[model samples]
Target: MQKNSSSIKSSTDILKQAIQFIGQHNITAIPINYTVSYEYCRGHHVLLRQAIDQAIVNKQPITNEAIQGWFDAFLLGYDLSELNKSHLDLNNIVDQLASTTTQAEEDVNQYDTSLKECKDELNETLDTSSLSSIVSSLLTSTTAMQIAMEQMKQQITASQCEIASLQDRLALVTIEAVTDPLTGLANRKGLSMAINESLSTALQSKNYPCLLLLDIDYFKKINDSFGHLVGDKAIKILADTLKKQLKGKDTAARYGGEEFAILLPETDLQNAWKVGENIRRVVESLRITRSNNHEEVFRMTISIGIARYQANQSINDLIELADNALYQSKNTGRNRVTIFETKL
Candidate 1:
């Protein structure tokens, strides 16, 4: 997931182009549509660009469904259909190898029988013609066995290489499925997987685990004032800051939109509060300058809510508690931390 960068003016220009494209096509200005159009304008995804270009050249109507299809096929890690096709191909290769191996085994058995016959013939009293025929038969059997073995070897080698390639692609697809393209953080699905694993381990080890939900204060205002590109930069900044502040064992994710979630293993409520407070202060101190006008600098703040896991608690319940505390923080002030207290 390499991020694409451009100057502020250039980004704004691209944004305008994207909007114009969407308008011309009579497509709705949804987030996905905007994203695909922006990427097309940037020419980042070659296949995506080509699809759009071809549609335009052929006078095909650009529809939302078409854009979404392209996004899923190209922008996303890999297409599900393509993945299934790869699996079918892998199965076919395996089947071919199996057949080849069976053929080779049969060839070896046949060659052995030929040798036995030749031995029996040699054991008997035979003339020059009889001996010559036996020798020729042996040569033919040996050659056929050699050719079968060679074919098997080549098939095995080819299959091995193909399987390795498929494995690599599957690994990449798995990563991309869980990763957020914009901030390079774990997406919600990844976060949930991490939570499940942590919860299972914590339940066994009796270790404390805490979840923190953070939301950028006035995030929509930032988007409205500067634009979505700048807003995206802000989110990336927060994500990077979280990565720096947290330990390797902790899991950080872009929960959704301007909100983020952090899972801390072996951490109690008190320690979680400290972590949340530290992040709040650090983000408050950050100065984000407008890319177009450096003189116009602004600061961003985040509100965090924390909830520690309890015995027999579900993941959804824990997240809800954290969300409640987050609502408390938002209601109290724009930037603060709140810890959820369970009523005994």
Candidate 2:
């Protein structure tokens, strides 16, 4: 009881200190910022603490973007302890199955030996009493064998169910690992995997894929004007618009804060530009209302850059080309699509 009380007190103290730190730094009290601050106050995450301290020493403002980056880099993903426990449970189930099978095999062998002895006894001259005893022994052996077989069958069925359940749990974990909690879209890791697979398929089919890198224009301004919550809502809106415009084979992912990536399989430069334009138009048309007041509304837009994959080009190279095109769109004007060209 004393230990529990101490833990509660420590947690409360950390929360208080985190709130104070946020107030001192003028940081937004968003969930991510609060979590990072709390962890920093706890002093258990050494790397996170070091990063925070380094930022302070450098006199850099701890912005929401920086906090989110830290959270993604350090605190994201499923817990390792839970994953380890799942693996251990699976192993135990497998061992139990193996032991059950071994027992069943031993029972079968014993039953086989009993049948052999009964057969040998039948071959010898025997009285009625002897024959009766032999028959009874055979019946008992057969009954035991049938029971063992049934037990083995039931055990195997149970093991299969356990294996199926574990597979389902692991599948869910895999999806969660690659998914962004906010937008219901793929995260950076998922995007990376999709890019690799698309590139590989393109290589085999001799058809190239197109990559699009998109960024919300002046996202920080939106965050500052409205708030992080509204900023997130705009992101979700953009994500939904992108999803609506994509083909079945296309992969869309949240690349990072306020940035999104789309991989278009077997798409040429012209079609990729058209897709980008459609998305840009859709995003530009969206007017989000502030949650606090229905009378207040704001608009957002996205800039897109497109690049077609070339033979023998790495994933990074393709992304760089797309990013360059995206930069051109951002530089000349916002809410436009730019295609990568050698001249640019």
TM-score of each: 0.72, 0.68
**Per-residue lDDT for 82 in model 1?**
39
Instruction: Evaluate all candidate structures by whole-model CA lDDT and list the values in order.
Output: 0.82, 0.83
1-344 in candidate 2: lDDT tens per residue? 46644554465456457758988999875445666887888898899999999999999999989998888888886233333444555566676678789999999899999989988998995789989999999999999999999999998997888678656655665666678879989998789889888877889898899999999999999999878998899899888888888878899999999999999999999998988898888888878886667655688888999999988888889999999999999999878999999764
TM-score (C-alpha, index-matched) for candidate 2: 0.68
Question: lDDT per residue, candidate 1, 182-282, as tens digits?
Answer: 88899987898899889888999899699999999999999998889889889999999999999968999999999999999989999999999999999
Candidate 2 regions with alpha-carbon error over 4 angstroms:
1-106, 109-113, 116-120, 123-126, 143-147, 150-154, 291-296
Candidate closest to the true structure, highest lDDT: 2
| Collision count for each candidate, in order | 0, 0
Residue 103 C-alpha lDDT in model 2? 90
